[model samples]
Target chain A: MVKLINADEAVSLFKSGQSLMIGGFLSCGTPDMVIDRLVQTALKDFTLIANDTTTPDCNRGKLISAHKIKKAIVTHIGTNPETIAQMNNGEIEVDLVPQGTLAERIRAGGAGLGGILTPVGVGTDAAQNKEIIRIDDRDYLLEKPLKADIALIYATYGDAYGNLAYDGTTRNFNVLMPLAADTTIVEVENFSDTPLDPNQVIVPGIFVDYMIVRNKHG
Target chain B: MDKDKIQEIIARRVAREFHDRDVITLGIGLPTKSIQYIPHDIQVNILSENGIFGVGSYQTEENYDPHIINAGGVGVTIKAGGCFIDSFMSFSMIRGGHIDVTVLGALQVDQEGNLANWCIPGKFTPGMGGAMDLVVGTKKLIIAMEHTAKGAPKILKKCTLPLTVAQKVNMIVTEKGVFEVTPQGLCLREISPYSSLEDIKQTTEADFITDLK
Candidate 1:
């Protein structure tokens, strides 16, 4: 069973300089209430692994604007001007990975695989500092698995057991982040009184550690 | 030509590349505009890297769902029978060579079919989103863009910017002309009605083999 907590208690689980995998594609599936609460906290210097930092006034970008993120491992940052500015000013370090490669690396981490071999970045700058292996005369860059101390995800519906169901494209990184982290906290919009049907559950209860039932106004 | 007309020319030309039931992925910006030009009779499955497999047209204000968005973060409608996927599954379909064609706007394309569109070093360093994966995995890679940038040729002998992928581009549809990238080099296939052979020759820095009518 997963314990249901408030947003304030969720904020207390973090420490400085921790690596967090945030689930979202430019704020669509982001844990808004948790992120909002985290922004008010004194925590800083977090390493964020997400698809994008989003915009300045939105979700993960708020963490960047608050100067809480020391480094970001993401696929895109063009939508967030603050992240670009921070990267340029040396305030935050950004490692730009290909979106597909980023997803596969997280999957590899959760699945306990060594790493992934991909031909996507073979001839590009993304291959820099990475090991290359050749098979059948084709070169592939070896991207290592990425694990995080915590994962912050969002779900449209969650049961007491923490079985979650995401809506639409909001399931982007949310499905993968929970598996790649030691502690997975989901900010749920609607809580069901009964256990959710197994057919409807996108994320099983075993992967979820905690749940934050959002306030009515939040 | 006017900016709208230039975009129309490129979009219309790129739209002709699609066939019925072809699974295509369109990059953000001008490539997305090509959706409007796709033939009505031909139904294609649009892939959005954000996790939807059968992406439909853009949504209006009334039908806008914040959760239903394309890779560019714009609200969009999903086609009938479209299914939602996770990031891992979405990329698996992309990197696994299931996508038939991918149309992307480019900053530079060299004669040797090298594509440079992701970064400009210090000026523009937006990360390579899924372009590197799409270009290598798609069955056909098409580049849709203007012929020049502020009168400067984007088609060059060598790409000054970093490459998204090397020697992967199959076709290029520009406002001025259509080009096929071959092992021998760039071959000009069709010239746009608004532009002449001399105009293309003058605006392009890369040498191309063409017998345009």
Candidate 2:
């Protein structure tokens, strides 16, 4: 069984200067209630790993706007002007990885792999300071896996066993994030008393540490 | 020319490049506009790196669903055969050479076929979303942009900005003309009726071989 907590308790698990893997692609599958609670906290200097920082007033962008993130390892920050401003001002460190590389790195981290060699970033600035390995006369950049202290994810439905099911494009990063963190916490929009259908279970119960049900007041 | 006219010309020209059954991905901004100009009879499957395949037209307020969005974060609808995918599978399709063609907007393209669109160092450092992966893996890579930037040539002998992918651009479509990137050099394949060869030469910084009369 998975431990069910409130939004406050969920945010309480976060610490200042810890790394977080947020599941979302521009706020589509993001944990809104948990992020809302996190925004009200005094936690600062967090390292955020996600796809993008959404818009200025949305999802992870709220953290960027609130000056909570010290470093952001993301694929794109073009949608969030606050992130861009912070990066330009040197207020925060931004490590921009290619989207595919970012996904593969997270997948590698989750799968217990040391790293992946990809041809995506080869011969570009992304290959800078990275090891170039050659096989079959083709060069590939050795990209290291990326793991986080905690994973904050959202799902359309979850059961007492923590089996998660996502909807539509919202499943983008949510499916890969749960296995890539030390503690995986999910904010479920709907809770099922019984176990979810085995076929519909995207992330199994073993990977989830806790879950918070979305309430009307939350 | 005005912005709308430039977009129309480039978009219309780029739409002609597509064939039926082509699985294509369009980058944000002007490249997305090409969908409106695709031939009515041709059927192309669209892919969005946000984990959607067979993407269709954008959704209106009445049909808007927050759960469905394109790579640009705009609400969109899916085609009949469309299906959703996870991020890992989406990138797998992109990096594993399944996509047919990719149309992208660029800040700069050069005679050497190097593309620079993702960053500008201290100025515009919006990360390379999936461009690096798309350019390297796609069967065809087409860059669609204006002929010049504020009266300065965007097509150059060599890209001054950081490259998105080195020597990977296959074709370039501009309001002025269409140029194909070959091992020999940039070749002016076709010139728009509105622009003269001299006009192209005056606005372009890169040397090109053209048979336009």
Question: What is the C-alpha DockQ of each candidate?
Answer: 0.88, 0.84
Q: When superposed on Cα atoms, how far off is each prediction in RMSD?
A: 1.2, 1.3
Worst 10 residues of 2 chain A by lDDT: A209-218
Q: Per-residue lDDT of A1-218 in model 2, one digit per residue for the tens?
A: 99999888888899999999998899688898888888898899999999999998998999999999999999999888899999988999999999999999999999999999999888789999999999899899999999999999989999999999988799998989889999999999889889999998999989999899988426
Interface RMSD of 1: 0.7
In candidate 2, clashing pairs total 0
Give the lDDT of residue A93 in candidate 2: 96
Superposed model 1: Cα runs more than 4 Å off: A216-218, B211-213
Local distance difference test values of all predictions, in order:
0.92, 0.92
| Candidate 2 colliding pairs | none
Model 1: per-residue lDDT, tens digit, A68-88? Answer: 999999999998999999999
- The residue-level lDDT of candidate 1 at A93 comes to 98
lDDT digits (tens) for residues B71-136 of candidate 2: 998889999988999888988898899988899999999998999999988888889998898888
